[model samples]
Target: MRMRITRRGGLVGLAAVAALLVGASPASAAPGDASAYAAKIQVTLLGQPAVTAGPFAEAKADGPTANSLATVHLPGILDTGVLNASASRDDQTGAVQSKASTADVRLTVLGALGAEGAGTRQGVGNNTVGAQLIEAECHATQQGVAGSTKLVGVDLGSLGSVDATPAANTTIQVSALGVDVARIVFNEQIHNADGSLTVNAVHVTLLGGVLGSIGSGDVILSSATCGPAGLPIPMASGAGLWLGLGLLGIAAAPAAVVINRRRRPASALAAEAD
Candidate 1:
């Protein structure tokens, strides 16, 4: 028996991912001296189950540690399903201290896919899917003593979906710097998959202030939470259906196997070396 499969949404998905990554602010050190503060990030998906293939396969991610800056990288393949991310920060200084955090991440769902078939495809043909979850956020804050007001700033960028369903959200943090600054912190969480959730945070504080400048120290904390095993939710199709339809044309090729298999192939295909 012979079946044919063709990847349809490659160009479109690549374009979206590229635009998402390139169209962003260039990274630079905070204006004036960097603030000394701390941050904590946490994220969770309400209705997602565990999966062996989707993003969030590894047990726990390499998280940030005390007094260290943290960075988390998502594997393209394992990144999928519903997503929720948030960040919070608290900072302290000799004259000022305050705290700030982004509580809710509205929406960021992208590139999900669904598949239909009895089992793995044969030698000449294979089943494939393209999935990814991505985001970039930055935050800062400064606070003075009690009775003194608190100033916090935050920026959040996340894009995700089940397939090519395309759910996106972007938020920018804006707060003025300079003052008898006290505290600072930042937190963020990205929904990975059913069982896997990636969370990260960065916290810091100032050793002291200079005559004309400020000095700061910070700690980084990151974590990945994997829930107990359970049923896998049906992944989204995104633009995978387009590809599946194209492949269906071949899978349902004229009178090859009497009738084409009813089962469907993954909506998207990510090129992977066998």
Candidate 2:
């Protein structure tokens, strides 16, 4: 005799298939064990030079600033994770000089799973990392305009390599009569299941000079990454279901904006100097 499958049975089978396709297995699909697992986090920064100064000289600058904090509670791999990355530049012109600074902070629970029990393990900590670039220019109508650019960035994963040549391109310009300035800063932190946390911070700066007009100077770049090692933990199936749903909410969140303001006029600079 032939057997018939019910609609409910078919729906259950289809759900199982969909979960497997996304790397979720019966063990992994269920909540994870936080006590025995650890996570890997990375961050990067990049900057570009494209500023000009003269009869209508102009300067532009931009850079990345990212911060994240998370609590883990399961035994699973959180590898190949990049928490934050950004790049920006500032462009201006005339006899005017300008300075501005802004900061952003975001707190998120990447994922959490596992049940409460005598065998459950718990911990708390933080990790931080960063990168930066600075460039400036000077000009002199008498002596032809001249300029120089430099890049100094730190890697969160390896503090020893902080002073090395940055993986990104950096440029600076200067004139005999003019002056330019630039600065970059980055910071980060992470918490793992082993009850431990690590923090990393990096800052970069650039300076140059020449004839003086400082006709115009442009460009800056930087990047960084960090990772920590620790044990794994257990997670309950119910927890896994909710964590998965939470990820969907994060994916649908709105994106942040990057501002690029117009250069100030020479008259504005003179008034500020006064």
Candidate 3:
């Protein structure tokens, strides 16, 4: 006589099959775990409040003076995760010849990474593993019209990779954003039972400018599949989101000025007419 499997047993078998499919899929199917982490970078140019230099007259030159500020926040979820990050800034001319000039063209950057959390290895229980790392870096620089380059950067390498059991070897989502900068990167490595290794690399880079004006940029992302090669799924979602937000800011700048002008009293607005 034929035997019938119980409904509960059928469901259990389906779950097992699904898990096997996910684990057996190529590396291309999973991107590094970036969705769990978020980063924001902001730069403000204080600009020269008052130009002390007289027209056609040069003031005494002082050494290049720079003021830079940076901050990073790592959530508990990503604590102990590895992070290797850096940032930089520069003027179109690329050189800050003097303190006053440096003030005229200042740069800043900020970044952070999520630390890996505690968990068991996939398919293997009872073993504890270390958290993964979140890496980041930032910097700024100045260049003279003659092509001299002066650059400064800050590196945050505390987050990059972590030790975790197989339970932590699942797929990870990622997102990244930046402005007027060169590159953003996130990567991961996979080790199989056979001892072979696979490395996944994802990065965003900025290129192109015209006559002192920054140009449009191109972004590319990998699909959520690694195939046989362990390539990180480069998701442009982060950069795209940032790009869209930046555009909105630019579009609103003029509106903000108009609104501020309108809010002023009529007498204040007409004061210059006297």
Q: 41-114, model 2: which lDDT tens digit per residue?
A: 22111232222211111112121222222322212211112222221211111111111111121111111111
lDDT of each: 0.25, 0.23, 0.25
Q: Ten consecutive residues with minimal summed lDDT in candidate 2?
A: 109-118
| TM-score of structure candidate 2 | 0.18
Every model's TM-score: 0.17, 0.18, 0.15
Angstrom error at residue 56, model 2: 31
* RMSD of candidates 1 onward, in order: 28.6, 34.1, 33.2
Flag the better candidate by TM-score, 1 or 2: 2
Q: Which stretches of candidate 3 lie over 4 Å from their true place?
A: 1-236
Q: What is the clash count for each candidate, in the order shown?
A: 50, 91, 59
Per-residue CA lDDT of model 3 for 22-69, tens digit only, reads 444443322121111112222221231211211111111121122222
Off by over 4 Å in 2: 1-3, 6-8, 19-214, 219-274
* Superposition error at 114 for model 3 (Å): 72
